[model samples]
Target: MSAQDYAEISTLMQAYADGLYHADSKALRQVFHPRLAYVCATPGDELHLDLETYTARIDKRTPPSETGDARDDRVLEIKLATPQLAHVTASMALMGRTYLDLLTLQRTPEGWRIVTKVFSYVPMEKS
Candidate 1:
C-alpha cells in the first residue's frame, strides 16, 4: 500500500471513532464493509457480530451523563499484509481507560473498508 492508501485508511478509521462518539451512523458505516463482522473480548471471553450488531453499539452522540474527557479516544496501528490487505488494530480509551479493537481490512470497489473488528477491554488503571 502506498503511503496515501495508509493515510486514507487511517482517516476513515478516525472518522469511525469520531462517529461512534457522536452517534453518527452514517459516518460510522462509511469505513465498514457491508458484511463487516466485529468481535469483542470481554473479561470473560470474545464476542462476535456482523455489521448490524456493530451498528447497534455506535451512538449518534455521547449521552449527557458522560462526564469524562469526551469518552472517545481511538488509536490505530496499521500493518500492511499486501497491497490489498492490511491488519489494523485500534486501542481505545473511553473515560480514560485503554481497550483493544482489532480489525482486518481489504481494498474494495469503494475503497479500503474494515471487514472484521475484534474488541477487548482492560483494567481502568494499573497497580
Candidate 2:
C-alpha cells in the first residue's frame, strides 16, 4: 500500500474513535459508507446493525467526552489487499468495555469509507 493510503486510513480510523467517543453521528457519517454492515457475534449476544441503525444508536448514547472518560482508541493494524480496499484492526474503550473492531474499508468515489465492521467486546476489569 502507498504511504498516502495508509495515512488516510489511519486518519479515518481516528475519526471513528472520535465519533464514538463524542457520540457524534454526523461526524461518523463522513467516514462510514451509507450501506455499511455492523456485526457482532459473541455467542448468545449477537448483534447486527446497519449503518443508519448504528449511527442512530450512537446518537442516543451519552458520550464519553461529556463524562470526561479517558479515550483509549488505537489502530492496531491496517492491511491493504488492493489499492481500493483495506482491512483494519482497531481497539477502543467505551461504556466500561474494550471493543476490538475488524473493519473493512473501500475507496469509494468520495474517498475511503468503512464498508463493514465486525466487532467484539469484553468488560474492562477494574484494576
Candidate 3:
C-alpha cells in the first residue's frame, strides 16, 4: 500500500477510537461501513452487533470524556494486505476494562471504511 493508503487508514482508526471515547455516533458512522459486523468473544462474555446496533449502544453510554477518565487509546498496528484491504489492531480503555480490537477495513468508492470489527476486553486491575 502507498503512504496515502496508510495515512487514510490511520485516520480511520483514530476516528474509531475517538468515537468510542466520546460516544459519538456521527463519528462512528463516518468511518464504519453500512454492513459492519461487530463481534466479541471473551469466554463467558460474547457479543455480536451490527453497525446500527453498535452505534446505538455507544450513543447511550456515558462517555469517558465526561467522566474525566484517563484516555488510553492506541493504534497497535496497521497492515495492508492489498491496496484495497487493510487490517488494524487497537488497544483502548473504556468503562473499567481494556479492549483489544482487530478491525478490517476496505477501500471503497467513497473512502476507507471499517467493514468488520472483532474485539476482546479484560477488566483493568485497580491500583
Using lDDT as the measure, the top candidate is 2
Each candidate: what lDDT? 0.75, 0.91, 0.90
TM-score of each predicted structure versus truth: 0.80, 0.96, 0.96
Clashing pairs in 2: none
Q: What is the C-alpha RMSD of each candidate to the true structure, in Å?
A: 3.0, 0.9, 0.9
Q: Per-residue alpha-carbon lDDT of model 2 for 1-127, expressed as tens digits? A: 8999988998898888888999999999999999999999566779999988998899899999999887898899999999999999998887898899999999999989999999999989987
lDDT of 1 by residue, 27-71 (tens): 768989999987777868677788876677664346322544546
TM-score of model 2 (CA atoms): 0.96
Clash counts for the predictions, in order: 5, 0, 0
The parts of candidate 1 lying over 4 Å away from their true place are 59-68, 71-76, 95-97
Which of the predicted structures, 1 or 3, would earn the higher lDDT when compared with the native? 3
Any runs in candidate 3 off by more than 4 Å, and if so which?
none
User: Which is the winner by TM-score between candidate 1 and candidate 2?
Assistant: 2
lDDT of 3: 0.90
